[model samples]
Target chain A: MTMKIDCPFAAKILTVFIKEELAKFGFKKGVLGLSGGLDSTVCAFLAARALGPKNVLGLIMPYGTSFGEDVRDAIGAARLLKIRHKTIDVAPMVDAYFKKYPTENRVLRGNKIARERMSILYDFSGREKALILGTSNKTELLIGYGTIHGDLASAINPMGDLYKTQVRQMARYLEVPAKIQKKLPTAGLWTGQTDEGEIGMTYAELDEILFHLVDERESKEELLARGFPRAKIEKIMSKIKSSEFKRQLPPIAKISSRTIGHDFLYPYDWEK
Target chain B: MKIALAQISPHLGNIQRNFELHLQAIEKARREKAGLLVFPELSLTGYLLKDLVETAALDPDKSPMFKEFKALSRDISLVLGFVEEKSQEKGLFYNSAAFLDKGKVLHIHRKVFLPTSGMFDEGRFFAPGRNFRTFSTPHGKMGLLICRDFLHYAAGYLLFAGGSEIIIVASAAPGRGLAGKNGFATSRMWELMGEAISRFSSAFVIYCNRAGLEDGIVFAGGSFIFNPFGKRLVQAPYFKNDFLVQEVDPAEIRRARKNWPFKRDDKPEVILEALKRIVHDYED
Candidate 1:
């Protein structure tokens, strides 16, 4: 299945979306964490175009286990856009906390690193008087591959709706650094940690199944008939089901008639 | 006569702010010497009003806000969308569009189709309108269809049967489906419908869609005008606030109607009879 999008059209619309949405909330500047991965690099390109290079800031937050090449690529992306950037080694803060509470689990340590980066991003956001722009694409968001309150937290996200494969298309159109585009997708949480490696499928296969399942609303049986592996379908479906909570606000128990997440419904852009 | 489509963003659930936007647009249209100014669906209250419908609902005849608009209409005719509160019942409301001309409410069209599926929950909030009718304007006989009402072919057909020469649609359609190189898939669908309706009905079709984002739903602001012969007169830019004013000669309506003669050959009695049979069969 060819899940192609008009790259130029998407780029124009996303740029406008970022600019207008930020202005709606009285923000003229934005700051986003740059992982040197395709997602953040694409976001950096869009943010630069939307808010101008001087107004946008990219933060490269990496732990001790992070690759030196990834850090360099992050700086390269920022320089390519001519935007201001800062590299903060998250090892000191993350290590300081884990020193008292030592754990052999890499996932736990990675989650801590993600949260530490978010904390630093917020600090920079306040210091620079800028809103934090999110970089999670539709694939990561749908499959629950992100850490909530960590990478998932941002005032606005222009690339969240675009799937991973679509982001690649956008990157090519935006002329993002070829090295970043060609590099294997990773969270850069620990050494040699790749997204597709952990997910156990290439982005092409995952996005095709996800597009059918989510966007086109194709059933599992229909996907099977269309030559999709049933096991992959089941695995993706289960992941989606399990990660549903990550997509929404915490359920507020209805103790009153007008609950925050229930009856008392207000839009996010509601200035009043 | 010149018709102005105000493709603007309405502040969500903020009547005062949106009303200010309307006044500004009205001033601009008047300065441009437009005979009529049309705003998008819920121009006073914005779309995605889940629980704020009642808060924004107003009785057109009783509200002080309309009085101001009515006074403004004395200078230029206006068409605007708002949640209409039924005077008799306190809670019953309709997604309605009003035509104000010469300081009076000429016609109010409560939206007949309340789309309540897949990212839309209009039926959950408001009552559906029952009739599709046309009202006389100084320029021509015009009909109003709000957003989803324009989607159903029957609404335009009914208005066409009612001797409408101009079909005005106020929409807050969300932008989606980015596979096409031209623009949004949703905007393309609206244009296709507008072309078909204008050609078959032999009436001018003016589509006014809102712009800007509300809770991530971007209202595709590709507002446009189709002449009586299905030729596009003008179109606004997508996803941006724009004011489009075009001079539409009333003579064009007559020429197109005479050339096509679709209305002269139309038979509504046949359609009414067929609808009755279809309804009976479906109920059975």
Candidate 2:
């Protein structure tokens, strides 16, 4: 089953929300890693809309194993958004560390590539004076599907609240390139690697279950009664409960009266 | 009804920028699970826009800015101040407050008692509103009073008579007088009135005011929410922009009214006939 969203309504709020949040922090320009995937495409379009096309810069940092069509689609998205974009092949940077200290595990190598791409993106942020906009959707963030300090490291993320399915819906509303929107979801970690093939379930199924469990706060029995299979329910619940650490700030042992992340909470624009 | 009061500074004559500010506040409120959000007077356009009124006048149903607002109201209700253009008439506008919910305009209150004295020259730019009535919302019956109108006790009386259980005040009041230990004199006075109204009418009061400088006038930022018993549930900081989300129970209205019996003993028809006879028989 497919999901539905009030596209125009959601788009208006999100664009303005992004624009105002950035302005409150005194930022006029934005930079982000755009991989031509649905998540990054949606983020790029929203960033362009918020800061204007000229103020937004898209950085396409592709690994050596990244599909050629994916890189082409990233270029197409940049043209469509009319934002200044650059293609920086991260193959050399990622390969440098791996060649010096070889790793046999495919997942370890993939994590290295992801973190290297993030490192390069940060360098550009300092050089260009732009905030790094994150592209990880709620689905990936909840399940720890992406590298921790890699794709998840962002100054601000407009897509953090949206589930993967909603990201696709937003892409359609933003009139993203049809080819990119229609393509299979991927992390581009390996050749022909798809997101659905990786996480062992479709985003539609995962998000629907999560919507009920997280948003609705449904009990396990209630979810099973709602026709969610027990195995799938247990699997998703385990993932949600296990990845709690990744989603949270590094916990500080209670030694002081008020610690940084514990009691001393303030808005991000506290000084402003 | 869970409510959020957004004490924001709006750019003068820049409806697009101001509209985005309103959206940002609304979206934040919705995330905090607030059912209703309120903004200060002329939130989409800052106050003291004497000549720029024509450019800022929005036909509630026509303006693209308002269209976006309606779309947002599908999930949460909002109260905001804007220049309302009468559809049938040109060049006639009112300093209006709107109650928007579920993609529809639930009610609108045109500021009736336009303050023309002292620093307030609202009557110079806006036509006076004639009637005060309460309208129904998804939460309950509600009324709207903008800025100076909230000060007039008669406004609350009329709203209570019209069955309003929640009174929303949206203001762009300038912060004035010596600062009290807690807040400004203007804000303290408003809080006193809010408490009095809550106890007298047995209704909740949601007050929203703007922050930041508009021209030379510094709009006060002491936005607050009071329960039916006049207890200050939440308050934003003074002289700076702030947003607060607080939970309010609609059930409290019934409990407070049951204890007070004010609405039950109220006489709307007698007051109406007496006022009518006074106007007809007496010379002012």
Candidate 3:
């Protein structure tokens, strides 16, 4: 007898929720930063379906020395889906920042690039009166693989749960370009940088362990017994713990009868 | 028109449990003869489930919960939140809301604004929705806004421009009051939103919020209704399960809009001045 594994059809289900939520908000258009990666590609496909191609705006912001093929693939995917799209090169803006600051460190340069990209997305969202759709997946969010207030920012997200591997699976289902589907995951921060290569573990393994530790509440000893490297576990666990601040709103100091972060308890729709 | 605000709790990762709660609310609304019933944002699946939310999300077309909701739409119109599948493509999901009446889904709104800052990562698990239009119900033409959408003036303005007589906001706003210092500011933010809605459109506004704790983040249940003149008509208790039912007259909305004429006074200079204030450029 074979036992069936339950697959999260999360993307499909979230599409409906997003539609209804948008209706509730009285918004007619959605905008997203399409980075030609597995996450953004998946998000774009979902947004296109949820809001219709006419109402979805996909902005592709590429910095200097981006993988040319990947950008082309992003354009191709948008065309295939017939979603509204535009490409804005951030090389000039990024170069200006560096020229003004004169930073040679790749990490600093990468951080500036991420933040610049976010600023552009938010600015465009205002101009279009559209919501900014986020593209970070659960693996990145859990490990804080994203920059604070940068790629980690958006008005709403639809793929925070799927791991990199799961995002790849969904990408295939969405018919994303093969180049994007096969490309090694990267923040495109600098030349020749890949997420797994930098993190020292593949998403498949990381997601498996993270699920066990966070969702299943497995202990470190149990994880070690199950063949997870103790060092890797420690590193990942520490990252999750340290990054908890990033996952929360700014700490508020309560001083009133009904404070929001402290005593005020209500749903998003409590005023009806 | 009497509207019922359903500030009920939703079970985490449990679609069936939430659907039952919604059904119960519908029954209560019908018994009360409420013309409209509202629920909180993402009420079908408790907010901030992290990755668990994705696994538990349900497709609107195929979900039994959606079917039950449609069936419940006989005597009253209802608004509720759920995870829905995008019809045009595969593997796409949205944070969606549905307007159900007379056993049909009249309209569906996907959340266009996803909050990804600080404690919210809506941009992580849901896609943004598009299309701004008000729905015409027996009670009146009404507009809807979700949690973060109300923070932006453009969303409310669009609804007013679309001729909405009333605007309803559904939210699962995390309890800032639980935070020792910032609670008052958050509360003030909600109050300001109420004032903005009335001032901008001179239309009645209703906010329905959820209550309870999920994943240690408590919801601040300050659900309330504002008359067309921006006066508080009814307010619900915070941090607990509660409901409010109030009657609204369409004539009040017309009278308020006619009297204020704020939309007419909304010129480019006025907009520029407002933008300056929003950007904190008080020197101008």
Instruction: Give the whole-model CA lDDT for all candidates, comma-separated.
Output: 0.91, 0.84, 0.77
Candidates ranked by lDDT: 1, 2, 3
TM-score of each: 0.97, 0.56, 0.52
What TM-score number comes out for model 3? 0.52
Sorted on DockQ, highest at the top, how do the candidates line up? 1, 3, 2
Q: Taking the tens digit of each residue's C-alpha lDDT, what string does model 2 give over B1-284?
A: 57999999887777888888998998899899899999999898778777678788999988887788999999999999999997887888899999999999889899998999876878878898888989999899999999889899899888888898999999998865331344455777788888888778889999999987543355668888888877888888776789988888989999999888999999989999999998899866
Which residue segments of model 2 deviate by more than 4 Å?
A: A1-3, B1-166, B169-284
Model 2: how far is B123 from its true place, Å? 41
Q: lDDT at A51 for candidate 2?
A: 89
Error in Å for residue A238 of model 2: 0.7
DockQ, candidate no. 3: 0.01
Clashing pairs in 2: none
Minimum summed lDDT over a 10-residue window in model 3 chain B is located at B176-185
What tens-digit string does per-residue lDDT give for candidate 1 at B1-284? 99999999998889999999999999999999999999999999998888888889999989999999999999799999999996887888899999999999999999989999998989989999899989898888999999999999989999999999999999999999888767788899899999999999999999999998888888889999999999999999988899999999889899998999999999999999998989889953
lDDT tens digits by residue: candidate 3, B1-284:
89999998687666677777888888888889998899998888777655554565666677776777888887789999877775554556677777888888887777788899877878877778886679887778888888888888788888887778888888888654221232322656786888778766888888888876554455777788888898888888765688778887778887887899876665756666788888996556
Error of 2 at B122 (Å): 36
For candidate 2, the per-residue lDDT at B202 reads 89
